[model samples]
Target: MTLRYHAHKPLRHHPGMPETRLAALLSDVIRRQRQLHELNQRRLAELAGVSQATVARIERGDRSPSLPALERLLAAMDLQLTIGVEELDAHLDARLTEQAARPLAEVLDGLGLDRIVDRLGDLPYLLTGSTAALLQGAPLPTDAVEIAVRWRDSARLTEWLNAAYAQRWNARWGEYGGVHIEPEEPGEHRWLTRHGELRAQMCDELPAGIKVRHGDRSYRVVPLVQVEATDPRAADLLRRHRQRQQAAEAPAG
Candidate 1:
């Protein structure tokens, strides 16, 4: 089945979007609307002043309707075709949550991480642990944020981070005199503001969905699916973590 995100209302299609992508998004919305209303192709065609074949083609991904045609089609389903900027991040977060409960493999497939990485410029950095989990609105056991780095590239990565997060770096190394960075202003560092308590690690294999960007931050998050699949201990850890969070958030009895 095609990946689908259910919307409480129809998605707004903005102008200047490529025709093919727009058509695909619109078709999904229309298909969902028709299913919600329990209307047959013939009924929708009659309501939209279109032929059944046309509606069939649109729903089947074989054709894209002109603007006027789309308007009429949406009107039939009590939806309006409008132009507006969509909150893409919020939409993506919703889609992530929608698939969170599925099998790890299924969640990975739906995320299309391979496809998403193609568009990102920076590479070779990983955002792991509870930080990634929280970004996607999933419950986590802890909030300690960690960025994984290749042991061979630790020095280079540290230099890059110091440059990127200038003025925040402590300019002093941890007692180990290694890759550890002592935040100058531990409680109010820029990295801390975006990713709580940033620390670096040298590792061989990073988790899935680990890239180099999370929202406005530079470190990318590993998808929870990957975390669960690659780390045998993750499931039990996450369960306990979530329970702790729920307990903390629960109202006084």
Candidate 2:
């Protein structure tokens, strides 16, 4: 059986989660718990007083069980569902807010931007995203050094990363060493290294950047307008920062 919810209403009234994702999470949790308990579908169904077909459907994400059904399934495996509230992206948001208040030069120093720039050595990169925003005089908080490099040059960049003992960041597995990095997939590719986190946006051709001077050094960074237009996260943070500044400056009512 398939389960559906109103498109306008998010699952459990959470701001970011959708019904489909919640269903998938439930499916994964149920399947993994059953496996951990060494119970097959038929055995689990017997313990939970549910049909084997119901177990199969739930595990396959073909059905969404009601609260009682879900609780029974979990109880059969000696597991229980617990819910807790968390601030989404709390760590990142806090970091951004903190960095937004500091000097851009200090932020760059903390990121070890010079080390990455020097390591990249003639690889032809332009600062992008929050890094670019900061270079363009917008105090955006960024945890990683973001750069755009040509697709053709990815191989060379990968070599540098590998030599520096960097590991590719995987969503499910965290970081692992010695994986080939390429622009085969679209969007940002990230790596964790001793120096810091590095994020690269591979492009067919390098984006236009303007020279900016900071702390007696010049760097090429994507223009603020382009960054605001293209990078939504950076743009949103910048927008919020500006709003806070405006509120602070406003006279009391």
Candidate 3:
């Protein structure tokens, strides 16, 4: 009863989408689960240990699920939501191609100093560590893939990122490596709007000697060249995503 596209569906999809849009996709799945379960807000509220208002908000796609809240609701239905690497990449591709694609400059005129991720068609190596913080939405986009962009995509990009923060998707710079970034706080929206168009740089491909600094620490956006050597599945997943992204690329922008 999850959100799924039937085989005969006509909608076309792109490869990996930006991180923010994926939150909407996930929220849609939860809403569908509620519908298929034939459970109303009141019923879900009782079974999931949430109030009617809470259930209503989640189903309306106005809110994202916290881990514990998701657990409680899943438990209520004897179901669990599992996100594998495949599903994650698939969702990313769909999102990237959904909205109109802007040029690199239009995507980055306002964000901070940064570089584009190479390997265009599919972004296989997600900057899954401290590297993510160097970007706008992913001050820590690890475990989440990073899409290298130019100044062109900045406004829409930031708008998209602000949406992610609103949903509590973690994008903050984590204290240390291996510590996942999570937007678990209430004021995360404030954190997102704080960057009032920081200047950044971007080349069509990865460049050497590019650098970015936040506080006393510096981060870089180097190609994830080694991931392909180690994980073959990662390569395949990204290839599929790239195909989808290119296909979804709108002609206007």
Give the best candidate by lDDT: 2
RMSD of each: 18.7, 10.0, 14.8
Compare candidates 1 and 3 on TM-score and give the better one: 1
Model 1 lDDT vs. the true structure?
A: 0.53
Sort the candidates on TM-score, descending order: 2, 1, 3
Q: 1-253, model 1: which lDDT tens digit per residue?
A: 2222334533655556676767667766776588568786778999999997777767765557877787788878777654556654334433434445455434333333333333223647575555456555564333234455566665565465555442232213111112334332232222322212344445676555544444444446777776655444445556555665587799998
Q: Look at candidate 3 and tell me the lDDT of residue 49.
A: 88
On a 0 to 100 scale, what is the lDDT of residue 208 in model 1? 54
TM-score of each: 0.36, 0.61, 0.30
For 38-145, candidate 2 gives per-residue lDDT tens digits of 677788999999997788777766656777898788777666665433465443445556676787778898888988888888888899999888887767777689
Tens digit of per-residue lDDT, candidate 3, span 1-253: 3322322111222347553455455455555566457675578779988886766555555546676786677667666665434544454454344322433233333233232232122322223222333232222112223334444444544455454332222222211112222222222222222322111222243333234454454445443343333335444444554565577695765
Best-fitting candidate, measured by TM-score? Answer: 2
